[model samples]
Target: MTPYKSKKSFKTRLVIAISIVNLAVILAITYLTYRWNAQQLQEQTIAQTQQTIEQAGTNVSTYMDELYRLTLTPYYNDEVLSQLEYSPTNSRDKLNSKRVVEGFLSSVMTLPRSEILRVYIANDDSLYSYTRTPNDMPDLATYAESSWYNEAKETTKPLFIEPHMERVYGEKPTTVFSVVRQLRSKNDNSKTIGVVKVDADYSGISKICNKINLNAGGLLLIVNSQNQVLYRSAPIPSGLEDAMADGNKIGQSGTITLNGQKYLVNVLSLSNYSINIVALHSYRTLMAPLRSNLMKSIALAIFCIMLADIGFYIIIQKFTQQLFEIVALMHHVEDGDLTVKAHVTTNDEIGYLAESFNQMTEALQNVIDRNAQLAKEIYQAQYLAKEAQYNSLCSQIRPHFLYNTLNTISLLIKCEEYDTAIRAIESFSAFLGGVMNVSKDISLQKELDICQAYLKLVQLRYQDRLQYDISVSAELYSEQIPSLTIQPLIENAIKYACEQNRGQTVIHIVSCVSQDRYSIQVSDNGPGIKPETLESLQQRISTPSHDETEPAHVGNIGLVNIAKRLRLKYGNSASLDILSSDSGTTVSISLPFTKNEVTQ
Candidate 1:
């Protein structure tokens, strides 16, 4: 025998191999754990951001609503409404009316609110103003041409205007959003008197939004429906400005890349005010801690792997000689020489392992011999079981069709139509003969004939109430289809159309060929199946039957049975599809052209 030689000893190779495997396993676990934690943390952050935005939106809405109530203050004061209706021709009466309106507006502004900068009342004849800050008033002559005034006129409710720098306050250039409402005559409510305008600065809304904490470099924006930013904590990025136009583009909360950095965006809509509060959180900043921890974990794992390899090297050195003998025998077994055995010199763990190895090889040889004997039997059993299942599905269709045809004939006889009854009996006999050989497939031509016979029987029973048209090319008729395939579909259309509908029902049977598929469609002009029933039927046909021998007794048994037979014959290459609406339902069966011939 050649002397056994290895470039490296078993102890050194084992220590290296074990160290590499341990390192790989540790890295994979660390990576997966990091990923899971990252996903969970991101989701939590997004959820919290959404909640915060909603709360801030609520606060803003409450503040705006309170401000709106202030605009209605004129209606509460009879003196202000009376002064709004005054239009004096003389300068003395005009000055007195102006004093009354200004006094009322000043009292309204003095209600302990610092945000309300100006209040004004205007009409066709004159304008009055009260200012809490040093600001010039807008011209009453040009006020009606303003966009906010036009919008305010459209509704009786107070209108909240978008933020803009007040043109009248030219020196200070104060940005303000205003509430404008129409002042109507109290005695004649439909008669217009004047309008009240309340201009408030952004300090109130800013205070509400400032409560949100989005970490460093994050932003919170208050925007209108037109995507105009009313307030933002930071300057808008380049692409992010256009992205905010469609809420559907970036849903309520998700991640987006802006300025080469990722961010988490959350949105809350104030529909009543046409406002949205958007929060942006920095993705890099949020995950910085996680990345740092991952790096530390990897460093610790490397150190642990080195320590474990050192300990494993010392332990493996103690028993390598004994294991080497067993390993050599294992090499012989791997080379198909199972007769080789290891020499046992001790009753320790290694000795027991060697004995068990010999017993395992002996048992494996026995199992291989038994498996060869069982394979043939199992295959034959499966073949018989499949055949039985196919035959059983075929048998189920015959009795159901037979019972219905016999009932139709009985109904015809009771109607005193002796000649039609005899004709029906003859057609029923022909249809019965067709279904007699249920185990074999027939050509599409024969299947069409079978469907025609069934339709003829149904047409006789319902007389003029049923009309059907069958159109298929003669060249395509040679394609083979499973027995009882097309007949059941035609029967289903007739039953729901003629039996369920009182009016005349029309059905169309057509066939067409595409790329590599041949499809036959059956459609009707009767009321269609309900959505729930159609879904149940489609599900039953799509799902495979767990028990091959179980009969198709649920949800349109005829359809379920035909679909199953098609699947059994052609596998998934065959399909049954259903389309329906209030107008009608269409059922189509598409089969691969390559499978046009019977598989037997």
Candidate 2:
């Protein structure tokens, strides 16, 4: 028995065992060696790139610090501050103050190598200047609306404005970045006088960003606190730039991808902590060395594998034939061809294995067929439940409506309004028959006719109390609405309003179509609902349970039922909205619409 077992084991998996052992040793060592080298290379590259980014950040901080410092000089300029606060009593006084402020601005406007193109105050005081006449600037009214102007006005610190198209020197648009500082009162230094704005040199920022080193397809950006680009060295595709541009706070490094190419993004907050310096590197460039090494390893692996080959082609063929046939059968099963069967001609272990596999597949196919049948039954059950619900609601509607309506007709006839009673009966009969056509959608026109008939009865019931109006268009008459959709809303209004015995109830049904949306609003000025009840009603309608079985109270004016039916038909593109207040309640239904959607 032991010898037989050993022979069976040796015959069963011998070629597989040797193949696995040989391949595993070769692959395991190669992957480990490759992984260690790649990790080391990545760490080294990260360190180098981090250092480069730090250096760039340091240089940029120094430059921005100089700009921040330039703002400090104006705070101490008591001469400009005194003039900025001075209120001129006469034209002569205004002239004298203007000249003094002009002298301060002229020197600033003409500074050598200055990025400061225009230095001006955004104040309307007769003495302080608004601009120094390179002749075209934004309107003074617009300055009040500018976000940076508001930021500067509210803060004591210097603010950096992101680059934008502005008429700084003339009417021609140019890229302008600005520094804003709130000027102090000369007499009382604690009080702010006005905002002082100086446009920075765009060329200078371009010089700084251009000097940073990056491989082709790489990018660099200098951004303000808002992460709006104040300067960018290269244009990046939208897919990559959108997230980076929107990112206000991130740690040192992250990865982003664009158009199938990966990028490494490094962020550094400048020393001032408001401005950010960003460096983006092409990931391929960083991984080029690793890729080259992988190719050499692959070549070496081929050489070793060639030397290790013992040439077992014939033996492997016999061993693999059964496996290949099994694989082909699996592929057929995967493609949903379940009819194919394995032909097991031998009585050996391979034949037994094939037979077992075929039996398993047949059982699996049977299970799938049963599942498909169950799915169809469940779908049919759902539709049937909804149909029964619709019919059930319609059946419930008839007795409630006909009872009240017949009573109203009797009242009208006794009051000697014979003509009105006859017309009411005809309208009632027409509406009652239409309600039972529950299989198809009825027109809004038919719905309106039902509403008119119902309202007539309601008026007769409470002759001086109920007044109703319908503003639905004749053109909209052909648009399909659920059977009894409008009537339920009217019924709900009449039911609650009459029960409360409100002296007067005014109901208005209005509908309109705009763009691709259609809406119907049923508004009523009646005794409003209690807030808690209204809330409960809304919650119940919007959040339906999965249970489709009819509840005990599925009879009259089921707002949730109407909502469920709309949701079931339109699949979330439709809505039922109810707004109620002390004075009135308005229920609105919205659905996707087009003129052609209205069937004859």
Candidate 3:
């Protein structure tokens, strides 16, 4: 009953934990998705606004091109040019010229274009005027002093001037933008005769801006080179003019806060005129859809979490039903009721678990029935595990050395060192003969002889690059240890040393006896193993293999295999250790010296 209560509590806590995690994950996903979509909508709105500004700028440029072409009408007419150049000696001649020039200007204005409010030709002495509306024109002296006249006088190119109130006109002062160009004498192109001016109201600019739809609370403005607003689609926002000025200088898109409302601003320059098209979109209005989407996402997350919580409850209940039955069986078994078995009801994981539980209880009953036989069987299994480990290590050691020795002999024969090659073959044959003694135990003297023969073949291959020394007390020569154990360690030392450096590598094998433990130390003066590699090797060797059916070891697993064989043969009384530094590495094997025989 206590176990059942604990499992029920655990199941309840697990369900709560899973539900909380699911809710947190779903809410986070909802928020992140909303943020991503909002960012995308912002970028898209900005791009669209910029594109519309570009289109409006193009339209305004085309309109200004037409107005500039109107200013060139005097150059196309011979009479107009003669009138412009005429320096009349009397008022009658002046009046005649004025009549002709004004008539020509009047004809130019009659082209069904309402945007052109007036046209004027002026010189230092006189001013001629034509207008759709009968408004007063500035005198020649007043026109000469104006900014447009001075700018036109300096450059032959038409100058598009900023807007200013035409206070001289009748009824009320009208706001007008004008294009002016200096007229030069046809006979002498460098000599200035007069200047022509064409004034336009905001109608054409308004038409271009109106063609673009900037949603609600959006603004479009046309500003002259002086940052003066020439046309506006809606009411102007404060600080927008300053932003436009900075934007024109830098020529980039940005966002600004205007009157406590965020606005995305984009500026497009009119290439044909010294003007810019500034478009402003309300950030709140543009992101309205994103707000809507965020609400939907949050609602969906709530629904999903609620649905997931219900589903988790159902699943936990279904899974824990079988789990509770297994728990009850476990309780019975804990009380020594081995006959209790969990009924298997389905072919799922729960069913398999129930079946395994039944098998476990039956096995427990069987183990109780045959305690003596089970102990004997366990002993035999341990012996087999040790024997299997030994044979696996021996097999790995035998094949690789043969390949190295044979390859060395082949290289020597190819060099025509027939005597040395024959001696290497003799050493190889002796080494193989000694290695074939598959007994699990071998005398230390016999192991030393095999190592000596192996080293001779290695010497024949490396020549002066290799050197070795073996020192053992004569009394300890007959000490029995695991076969192929010391030889593989020596091989590992020589193999690492010669492979890493061209300089001479020294291998020293010495035996020491202290009290009851005999130790063999193999030292190498090769480039030592890296700290990480040495640590990994130590970890691999120290862990005992529990599975006998594991695949045959490969690579440098030979070191690990030898360590395992030693552990199996002598149990905890034996150990293999590796010590290394930048200078060198040493491998030590320690075995208890009780007759030098392994545990049964």
Candidate 4:
């Protein structure tokens, strides 16, 4: 009897010891998994956030390039050059000059994005422009002594003048960018006939800077090469002036406290421009998402650990009837059989183990089921999101087509060409019908046709003001593109180039094969964008005045939207770039060259 009692006591003690050891192991595994998952989540979140910011920067740069190429360059070439070259000299010339200047002003005023306040022609001892009355002409002889006139004469190139307080327009302060071109007769290239001066208001620069939406509580500023503020969303403090002195490159990053709120300031230099852009985003905005994600992860980890503990306890108790049942249950759980339950009975050490086992199994099973449901929901949500995006893309086509068609109608009306109008209307209807019925992905040929149709409409609208030269390789016309991709860009080009200052807008649309990709380029010779405007554009910060309907400068929305769409469709495989100078601006896009059959 003594031996029997001793053996039973030993068995009970052994069971208790084994159960405690198993519980400790289970808890350790649960804690480790929680920590590992949390760490991974944190790292992933940080990586994604950084990627988003980087992509935003890339997008801004690309958009700015497009705006510069499509809008600014063409205006400078056609309108400004014509006005400069042909201004009249005699009484008859003076009469013609009045008509030409008035016509030019009318055209400039009609351009929605034109920042030019007025244009002036300086010839001999007379200065002619709509800005001055015949009786109130400013002293033309004294202008050569002024810095702007001297600079224009010195550079022999288009000059963007700095901002200054002016009393000419009113007591209200005004700034202007002046482009002066020496006009000589075609027969006499060496003799300077006259000077054509285009004056763009600084308010236009400010308007462009204001439209970029960087972030909440972030400010975007455009400063000239001289480190003088060309445009700012807000006033700069005197203390920061020394840091922003002429030719000084603002450091890439720094901490700045404004209005008691800390901001992370970043400055990016514009490519091929002498301007610098400064961006200031609140540090709190950057860290808020990270903190929220961390807190949620911690809460989830704690909940998971508590569940693991309860599951282990119940699982141990339920499987106590068999001495090794708890061990077998643990093995099954480890093998991912979260549903396995310990079925044990007895009121001794085994029973206590069984109760713990049941508790553990219950908790783990609940967690597994919840995770499975969550995964299913996430997958469904992703599918729905994709579907919504597709639908949104489909909807965008109609408005664009309608806009182009209406423009065509307007042009036909102006020309009073009834037959051509009818034909164009019919073509537009058929195009719309085909577009709506066709698959989302279309042949490159079809895309080109769409672009041609749109361009025809634009040409009709602008009449003789707009001219385009399209050169596409026959073999490359079958490559696929997202529907309406090139049209928006073209529209943006016409909006800025054709409409600005009655300037002759020349758009060169050319396509070629480069390496393994198909490249398309749109080049224009308009009034080149200000360096500060280009810099502000590259930063993508929405200025405060962007909500105004008629912006004084070109809007960045079309460029940004196109870039984002490209990224969504083609990931990192596609490319877009903009190069601008005083002479012209070029926007180029490249995409993978797939065979026509593959695109279909």
Which has the greatest lDDT?
A: 1
Candidate 1 lDDT tens digits, 1-600: 222345144335655666777778888999899999989988988888787888887788889889888888888889778877767779898888888889888766544676777887777677788775544546446876776666665667888777776643335355677888887889997878887888887878887777778765578987766666778888776678766654433447677887788988887888777777888877787888788888889878876766566674566645655676877788888887767767677789988988888798788777877897799789999889888888888888878777778988998899899999999999988887776754368888788888888898889888889999999755466678788898888888877766888998899999888778889999998899999989888988898878855777643878888888898888899999989888888999999875342211
**Candidate with better TM-score, 1 vs 3:** 1
Q: Which residue segments of model 3 deviate by more than 4 Å?
A: 1-31, 87-96, 133-141, 144-155, 168-174, 187-191, 215-217, 225-227, 238-252, 269-274, 296-600
In order, the Cα lDDT scores of the candidates are: 0.78, 0.69, 0.77, 0.60
Per-residue accuracy of model 3 over 433-458 as CA lDDT, tens digit each = 88886476878878888888888888
lDDT of 2 by residue, 1-600 (tens): 354455345544554444556666867777788788867866665566677768887776677677767666655667766767767789897787777776766554336445666666755453234343343346455776777667887888888765666665435566776677877776787776777776665677677778877654467777666556667877755765676566834446777677888777778877454567777777777667667777677656654554345355457646656755776788898998887788776678878888988998899989999999999999999888877765664555456656666777788889898887887777677767666655447777777877886787677567778888889755576677677777778877877765475577888988888888889998888777789989878877777667633452543345666776676667789988889887877889898774542222
Q: Evaluate residue 398 in candidate 1 and report its C-alpha lDDT on the 0 to 100 scale.
A: 77
RMSD to truth, every model: 26.2, 20.3, 37.4, 22.2
lDDT of 2: 0.69
Which structure is stronger by lDDT: 1 or 4?
Answer: 1
Candidate 1 Cα lDDT to native? 0.78
Worst 10 residues of 2 by lDDT: 126-135
Which tens-of-lDDT digit does each residue in 1-600 have in candidate 4? 354456456545545545555555655665566567645644444454344434544554564344333223324445444555565468986666567655664455324445545556565555656453112224455765666565545444555443443434434344444455555544455655455555455555455556665654455676656666766776564445555663455656556764566666666665444555676655566556555655665555454545554554566544532656666678888888877777656777767787788898889889889999999999999768656664565565456557656876878868899877877777676566656665767776677777777677566556688888888776676677777677666776776666773768898888978667888888787766678877776444223233222222336655554554565577678867767777667777889887453211
Residue pairs whose backbone atoms clash in candidate 3: none
Clashes of each: 0, 1, 0, 40
> What would the TM-scores of all predictions be?
0.42, 0.40, 0.41, 0.37
